[model samples]
Target chain A: LAKTTQPISMDSYEGQEVNITCSHNNIATNDYITWYQQFPSQGPRFIIQGYKTKVTNEVASLFIPADRKSSTLSLPRVSLSDTAVYYCLVVENDMRFGAGTRLTVKP
Target chain B: GAGVSQSPSNKVTEKGKDVELRCDPISGHTALYWYRQSLGQGLEFLIYFQGNSAPDKSGLPSDRFSAERTGGSVSTLTIQRTQQEDSAVYLCASSLTPRGGPSYEQYFGPGTRLTVT
Candidate 1:
């Protein structure tokens, strides 16, 4: 598992596109970049994952650069319900979490 | 279609007492994991079980903390002589297989909140 660094918090108004960037300079070749969303009093939910380039799903998008040292999660048309903690992880078989970026979508 | 489930959503015990927490992984899932999260803190990996065997128990905080999985489906985490520091939310997750598999995305349980007095 590779360690990741991300912003402590971010704020956006409803209807805005929000992008949270994470840095994992020591990523391994087999490591995959994955993201999760967590709300208060609930377990984390898987959002998206990618090895390289870009991967998109109904919930969000993950963009991994060519170097694979960093990645970004793009959330489109944010709403008040989208407010939650976003976590970025680089892992192969192990699971670890950092102080995720808390996104606050204000009305 | 059910996800991982945990028993005793909350537990409160004295410092010298023992407590047990249970987790039921998703059906047919071969991998299970246990993690603890303190208030406003990142999750701390405690153990991992592949099938019925636990290959990684290094994350267990101390000797007093132990876990076992039977039938590769249900797991129990037991804590003896609980201390106040042991208070935290214990979570469980399971995937069809470990990472690198076609469907390794983990599904998590709501977690058991333990409060040791």
Candidate 2:
């Protein structure tokens, strides 16, 4: 499993774009980058996943660089309800979770 | 469609007692997993079951912790002689599996909060 590092917390205003970066220096060739959103007292929910380049979905977009050493999760036009803890995980077959970045979208 | 479901959302047991937690996965999902999460800690893998084969119990913390999945649809995680450290949120997830193919993304259920006194 690849270890990931991310900020503990980030604050952004409503309607603004937010980007959370995760560093996985030991990422393997077959590993995929996955981001999940977690609210208090609830299990984490999958937001986006990507192996390379950029993958966009209705909820969020995952940007993986050419090196694959890092990836970014971008949320556009955030609202107050979007405030939640974001987890970045790198996995091949088994799953591992990090402390995650707590994104606070304030109005 | 129904999502994953777990029973006994909250449990409070005294020390030296045993407790059982149950999970019912979504329809058509063949892979199930159990994980524990403590306050301020990351999710810790406990065990995994794929179809009717033997489970991967490598992540079980201690001998007192054990889980069983019957008929590949429902699972029960048992904790014998519970201790204070066993108090945490126990989560269950399930994913689709194909022969020789990778397991699909896991769908999680609301966890059961266990408090061992």
Candidate 3:
């Protein structure tokens, strides 16, 4: 399992774009980068996933470099309800969670 | 027509007693997983079950914590002689399959909050 490192917390104003980056220096070739959002007292929800380059969805966008050592999750036009803990995981069937980035969207 | 479901959304038990947490996965999902989440903490993998075969119990914290999946659908996580440290949210997730093919997302249940006093 690849260990992930991300900021403990980030603050952004409403309507602003937010980007959370995760570093996984030991990422394997077979690993896939996945991002999940979790709110208080709720389960984590899958936001987006990508293997390389850029993958965009209605919710968020994932940017993976060619080295695959790190990835970034971009949330466009953030709202107050978008405040939550964002987790970046390098997955390969084995599940391991790092301390996720707590994103706080201010109004 | 349904997502994963867990019963007894909350449980408060006394130390040295036993407790059982249940999880009902989505129909036809062949892979199930159990994880523990402490207050303000990340998920801790407990076990994984695929189909009717034996589960991968390597993530179990101790011998006191055990889980079983029946008929490849529902699962029960049992904690014997529970300790105060067992207080946390027990979450259950299910995926389409665990093999190395194209992977589907893992859907999670609301989880059962266990408090051992």
Candidate 4:
């Protein structure tokens, strides 16, 4: 399993865009970059996933550089409800998690 | 459609005793997983079951922690001689298939909060 590193926490105001980056220097070829959002007292929900380049969804966007050593999760038009823990995982078969980036969106 | 569901949303047990947590995955899902999350901590993978294959138990913390998936739908995680450290939220997730591709998404249940006193 590849180890992932992300910021401990991030703060953003409403209507702002929040970008969280994760570093996985030892990512494998078969590993895919996936992001999950976890609110307090709830299970993590899938936000977006990508193998390389860019992938966007109704909720967020995932940017994986050519090197694939790092990936970024971009959230547009942030709101207070967007406050949650964002986890970036690089996995193929074994799905492990790291200390996720806690995003606090203020009104 | 109904999402994943877990039983005994909250449980309080005494130390040195045993406890069981149950999970019901989504219908037609062939992959199920168990994870543990301590307060303010990230999820820790416990085990995984894919199709009829042998479960992947490499992530289980100890021999005392065991899980079984019967009929490939319902799963139970059992902890023997539970200690205070065993207190945490047990989460269960299921996906349509195992590593089909980058599109695979794991749907999670609300989880079971266990407190060992």
Instruction: Give the alpha carbon lDDT tens digit for every residue of A1-107 in model 2.
Output: 57899999999999999999999999988787888888888888889888889999999998999999999999999999999889898875566776889989988
TM per candidate? 0.96, 0.94, 0.96, 0.98
User: TM-score (chain A) of candidate 3?
Assistant: 0.97
Q: Quote the lDDT for A73 in model 3.
A: 98
Clashing residue pairs in candidate 4, if any? Answer: none
True contacts kept of each: 0.58, 0.44, 0.44, 0.71
Candidate 1, residue A81: Cα displacement in angstroms equals 0.8
Write candidate 3's Cα lDDT for A1-107 as tens digits. Answer: 67899999999999999999999999988888888898988888889888899999999999999999999999999999999998888886678766688899988
Model 4: residues >4 Å from true position, as ranges?
none
lDDT by residue for model 1 (A1-107), tens: 57899999999999999999999999998788889898988888889989899999998988999999999999999999999999898876567788899999999
Off by over 4 Å in 2: B98-103
DockQ of each: 0.65, 0.47, 0.56, 0.74
Per-model lDDT: 0.89, 0.88, 0.89, 0.94
After superposition, which runs of candidate 1 have C-alpha atoms over 4 Å from their true positions? B100-102
iRMS of each prediction? 1.8, 3.5, 2.2, 1.4
Top-DockQ structure, candidate number: 4
> Regarding TM-score, does 3 or 4 come out ahead?
4
* Model 4 global lDDT (CA atoms, 0 to 1): 0.94
